[model samples]
Target: MSRISIIGTGNMARALGSRAVAGGNAVEVIGRDASKAEALARTIGGATAGTIGAAPAGDIVILAVPYAHAVPLVRQFGDALSGKVIVDITNPFNHDLTGLVTPEGGSAAQEIAKSAPAGAHVVKAFNTVFGHVLAACTPEDPRPLDVFIAGDDAGAKAHVSSFVESLTLRPLDVGDLTSARWLEGTSVLLMRAMSGKAVRSSSFSIGLTVRD
Candidate 1:
């Protein structure tokens, strides 16, 4: 188990925070609203609350914010995030849901990396699934959830994988950070699928199956 700091107090924060606490990891919820953060932490149980601009106490920092705010928020964190593993879980979708909002050939994670301070490693993950679905997952669940991770640093990827494993989920290492763009694209497809353009159902999470 690892110390986890989630930089948001919304649905994703509560879902992930609860899972982290259940996994025996130290969970901290950071938000612009101090009271909201405190309330979320209390609801999650066994977790701490923090203000947005303060230095995160955990080595692993999860950005549960929106894509539009991710880079600016990273810049705001500045040197305080140095040497921390920053996990980006945002889908940079266009307003109409027709496409991504990131610049051509760029992904939300890559843009976030550009704003990250020296020594901080940014990894793309947790974007392919919705918060409610993630919240439903547990170590005791019979079904498996596949968490695809993409990052430039091997140690950082391994560190994130450990946290994913703590929830009893599978971590699929797709490749280096360059693959983040595809992961973001994966989310776009998921959005459309969940919107009924591709799939007629809403009760599903992307899963990987391998057989020998």
Candidate 2:
């Protein structure tokens, strides 16, 4: 169990915060709207809330904000984030979320990594799944959700994998930070598939098989 600071109070943020608390971790929810953050924190239990600028230090920081908001906030956190694991849960989708705002060579996670303090590891994750699914996750299903993770630091990736497992989800190692481009692209495909056009409520699952 690790201390987690979540920067955002939207559905995704609440979902992650609730999960963290349920997993017996100290959780903090930070947002631009202090009242909203406080409300979400209360609902999650065993959590505190505050403005992003005043967020407490934690072992891991989850950037649960939108893609457009991540870069600046990473810069703002600056050296404060050094020596910690950063979980990027944002999708670089625009207003309609039909596509990405980043260029071919750029990704939201990469941008945050570039601006992060030295020693801070940025790992991409939790972008492909919907908030509702995350909120309802249970071991009875025991079926792992495909959660893609990419980071330059192996230790950081491992830490994130443990966190994912704590939530009963699978960690799909997609390679180094550069692979974030494709991971984000995968999210776009997921969105399209889950959309009513093709299949409603369509989602991805991860499985492991052993051949004796």
Candidate 3:
């Protein structure tokens, strides 16, 4: 089972933490507010709670915070995250949501990697799906949700792919870390599509089908 430490107390954090626990993987909920983290840990069940900035217990770290906070937080963790696989689940959308905050070709995952230690592996993932749908303990959809992954390290990407599979999700590796920018664009595009339809996570999801 994958040992995952999710950093945040927000919806994404709660969603992923609950899934990890339900999937029988070890989970740790770390938040800036220790009490909230503890509460979420209890709510998710089978998870340990921790204060932010502490040494993370899991080999895999999920940065579930907002895109704005992602870089600074990773810098704060610094070498503490050495040798760990970091899953960047952020979308660098601007305030108006008209465009991204990151440079044209650069993505949040690539920028995060700049601050990470040499040994740390940063993989971009889970930006294309809605948190509420992913939060469900048992998915009702006949087709499993698609999880697009991109990273420079083959081992790291494989590690994340395995974790996604463990949670009953499908992992599709588009390419190396550079493809994260495209994934971020896809996320924004879908968000815009959902804006007009008023569609919820259950009704709207990204799926992959292969033809025989």
Candidate 4:
């Protein structure tokens, strides 16, 4: 298992950190609020907590913050993130949930990738799954949630896939980083669906199931 460092102490961070610890991976939670990060780490168990800009000790660092804070956060990390696989798990959505917030011709992952330092591989993943589902489901769940991954680096994608599988989630490689645009779009649709009467409950999640 890989060491997972998540740059946020919010809901997504706690959910992912729980899975990482359950998978026997060393988890680190870093946030702007040191106390909040420490509290999250303690709640997740078997994880460490620290403030942002401290050198990430894990090979895989997850940007679990909001879309607005992601680029600048990566920029702030700068060279400290070099040689690390950075996972961007953000949905670039408008406030009303009617559409996406990404700039024209740009997705959140692509924008974050632009700000990433050299030697860092930016992978887009976990944007499609809601934090509620991530918090509820585990390796013991009958149906594992699907985590769609997109990245330019094959090795980095594989590394992320291995981690996802370790947590008993299915990893779907949807091709290069350009595919992230569609994944972000999917997130918007899923959000709208969840808010509408379609999903009915917050426990629902999206996944790909193939049958011969």
Candidate 5:
């Protein structure tokens, strides 16, 4: 089991925390609200809670915060994150969260790579799925969920891919860090679809099947 630290206390943070703990990993929920973090930790069983700065150094660190909050938090984590696999799960949505805010030249994940500590291996993942789906979906379902992952570091991407598989999700290798813009942009379309009632079920996943 891997040691995982999630920086956030919102629905996504709690959902991922629960899944990590269920997978028998050491999970920590980090947030500004001590009480909420602690509550989520307790609810997730096997997990712990603490302030973002106090979160234990783990093999994998997931930034589960909003797009606007990601950069500042990453700057604060700074060198402390060196040598760890950092998962960028945030989608760079605008204030209304109805459209993309990241630049077309690059993505939030790419920007994070530029700002992260030199040794930190940044990977973009867990951004396409909704928090409710993450919390309720099961691996045994006929159509397991799929997670898209992208990163410049092959080893780091492999590690996160294994974790996603362990959670019973299909892992789609979408190529290097540059692909993050597409994945983040896809998330915007997903949210819009959800709002339109086009994707009313939490079990619905974005995937493709090929036939020869």
Candidate 6:
């Protein structure tokens, strides 16, 4: 069982923490607010709670905060995150949601990688899935959700893929860290698609199917 530490007390954090618990993995909830973190831990059932900067108990740290806060959060964590796999779930979409807000030629995951400690492995994931859907399994489909992952380190990617599989979710490796740019774009596209009146349901998710 993989130990997981989720940063942020928002919906995404709760979603991931709940899934980790359901998967029988150890979970730790960290947030800026101690009360919220504790409450979320209690809600998730079987998670420890702490504030930001508290040494993470999980080898995999998932950042569920806003894209703008990702960089600074990494900087603050510094070497404390060394040797840990850092999962970047933020979508760097513009406020208007017209497009991604990533710096030219750089995705949010890449930017976070730059600020992360030398030994930290940064992986981009969960940007394409909606949080509401993440909180629970898809209603119409009994299968687990698909989680596309991109990262520079093979070992890191494998670690994340294993964690995803542990939760019964499909982990699709879309190549190295640079592929995160495309993933971010996909997130923007999904956001636009969901915002349109054509799709009224929130239980659906984006996935890949391969026939044998």
Tell me the tens digit of each residue's lDDT in model 6 across 2-83: 9999999999899888888988899999988899999999999989996698678899999999999999988988888999
Ranking by TM-score: 4, 1, 6, 3, 5, 2
What C-alpha RMSD separates each model from the true structure? 1.1, 2.2, 1.6, 1.0, 1.7, 1.6
All candidates' TM-scores? 0.97, 0.90, 0.95, 0.97, 0.93, 0.96
Q: Answer with 2 or 5, whichever has the higher TM-score.
A: 5
The prediction achieving the highest lDDT against the true structure is 4
- Give the clash total for candidate 1: 0
60-129, model 5: which lDDT tens digit per residue? 9999998788888888888888888999999887756566787767899988888788889999998998
Each model's lDDT: 0.90, 0.82, 0.89, 0.92, 0.84, 0.89
- Misplaced by over 4 Å in model 5 are 95-98, 200-203
Alpha carbon lDDT at 163, candidate 5: 85
Residue range 1-212, candidate 3, lDDT tens digits: 89999999999898888888878899999998899999999999899997688779998999999999999999998888999999999999876679889987899999999999879999999999888868753655578889999999999999999999888888999999999999999888877877766565434678688899
Measured on C-alpha atoms, candidate 1 has an lDDT of 0.90
lDDT per residue, candidate 4, 119-149, as tens digits?
9999999999888788888678787899999
- The CA root-mean-square deviation of candidate 2, after full C-alpha superposition on the true structure, stands at 2.2
Candidate 2, residue 87: how far the Cα is off, in Å: 1.1
Model 6 residue 146 distance off true place after TM-score fit, in angstroms: 0.8
Instruction: Compute the lDDT for candidate 3.
Output: 0.89
**Which 10 residues in a row give candidate 2 its minimum summed lDDT?**
200-209
